[model samples]
Target: MTGKSEHDDSEREFDYRWARDAPHKEPSARARMLAARWKENPPEPVPFRGEPEASGPRRSSWISTALVLGCVAAIILLLGYTRFQAPY
Candidate 1:
């Protein structure tokens, strides 16, 4: 009888499950995480520059050489000089 009465104490506590039914107002996981990050720090807006920031000079010096060489070849071909090998 003593053992059975001792175990009944666990179940005798008042439950407030009905109190939680008022609104169940709680932030969602995302909202909670966002709030925690906001509290820890502050919100920062993303930069929206009109033109995308260039990483660096994308064109290499060799590309300029190739372009100049192509123009020279065009001028040479237009001058009616026949080459041993076809331009193609």
Candidate 2:
């Protein structure tokens, strides 16, 4: 095999001459008509409807929060007590 590695060979060059030399195409008749119509009469902006405000003051129920915390504490205490009494 040749002592030179694959990377040693020159990289292939890309031909961008076609893009630089290509002619620009004109817009179609239908496309032109639509563009003219859009320019003459544009659509109206939709009305923004904000969310309705709550009837009463938004406050968390203290009773519900306290109950949830109590349940979590009781679960932790029960688990700890069971682990302490577990057989060695």
Candidate 3:
């Protein structure tokens, strides 16, 4: 059996119920003052600056194509030169 007595269990249950049903307290003076001030003069929304538009023409795809073709050509030429120079 558990060590706790029936009295202790009832006391804990009563405390829990009391805390759960507790009344809500009134707002503090500072909170009420700020709320009143906001009601009197609500703040205006500040306008955000939009992103800048693209100023110049976009780069062409041919530049990247040419770069890849040049790399492949260089690799091919290097392999050919090495194969010829290697002694049998």
Candidate 4:
């Protein structure tokens, strides 16, 4: 029968505390090589939805305006249909 202690005597206790005051070791050779490689060849920018980003915002605002108008028209139609078709 085990006694009312947290851990058994034979069991090794794992230290979960971070050693904040411990000396920082130099980066490993592999880490240094990776850093150097990254410095030489940086990662390319991710493609925007499989397409390159526009160099400038040369796109006209008319498309967005038309979309907004279409949404408003749909909402008006829905409201009108619901109001007029009510079984009062």
Candidate 5:
């Protein structure tokens, strides 16, 4: 029973060979309208400054270095006091 139905479907199926020779048409109406609007009012490019400030002797990391050294010194002091001094 299924085989007969399959044969009938195969006979009624659409042929796709003609699509290869069909001529292509221009863009759809909606696409043309959108393109025209974009062409008439395109978006502006974002403003950008020249070469970003060079890393020349103009920048300093002394503050960051001092903070790190301070943290290390505090940790070392706490450890030494805990080991050598009597607990309160």
Candidate 6:
């Protein structure tokens, strides 16, 4: 599955250029209508920040638990190895 017997040089180039340089223009009447509507009913409020303390404690608890588990696993592995070591 390949070129102009299918789709080759000129067609492929045309498609690429069409996507890159397509014009986007709203008609003048539509633009004026939008401006008039916005002049009366403005946009709604948007809060950008979250509750810092709410997330902070949870993140710290997760890190602490992960560290504890990792230490416990390492200790278990060390004990297992010691139990099987050949005495010299």
Question: Against the true structure, whose TM-score is highest?
Answer: 4
Model 3 spans with C-alpha error above 4 angstroms: 1-58
RMSD per candidate (Å) reads 14.5, 10.0, 9.8, 6.5, 9.3, 8.0
lDDT string, candidate 1, 1-88, tens digits = 9988877986786557855775767778999999899998988776676667789868889999999999999998877655535485
Q: Candidate 1 regions off by >4 Å?
A: 1-56, 81-88
Best by lDDT: 3
Candidate 3 lDDT tens digits, 1-88? 3656876786666565566577975688998998999899987675697667898986689998999999999999999999999999
Question: 66 in model 1: Cα distance from truth in Å?
Answer: 0.1
> What C-alpha lDDT values do all the predictions have?
0.81, 0.79, 0.83, 0.78, 0.83, 0.76
Please, what are the lDDT tens digits per residue for candidate 4 over residues 1-88? Answer: 5663545653555443533444775788999998999898987887667866669876479988898999999999999999999989
Per-candidate TM equals: 0.27, 0.33, 0.35, 0.42, 0.34, 0.32
Please give the range of 10 consecutive residues that has the lowest summed lDDT in model 5: 51-60
Order of candidate numbers by TM-score, starting with the best: 4, 3, 5, 2, 6, 1
Clashes of 5: 0
What candidate 5 gets wrong by more than 4 Å, as runs, is 1-40, 47-59, 86-88
Q: Comparing 2 and 3 by TM-score, which wins?
A: 3
* TM-score, candidate number 5: 0.34
Candidate closer to the true structure by lDDT (higher is better), 3 or 4: 3
Which residues of candidate 4, in runs, are more than 4 Å off? 1-18, 25-33, 36-58
Model 1: ten consecutive residues of lowest lDDT: 79-88
RMSD from true fold, candidate 1 = 14.5
TM-score, structure 1 vs. true: 0.27
For candidate 1, the clash count comes to 0
Candidate 2: stretches off by over 4 Å: 1-60
Error of 1 at 49 (Å): 28
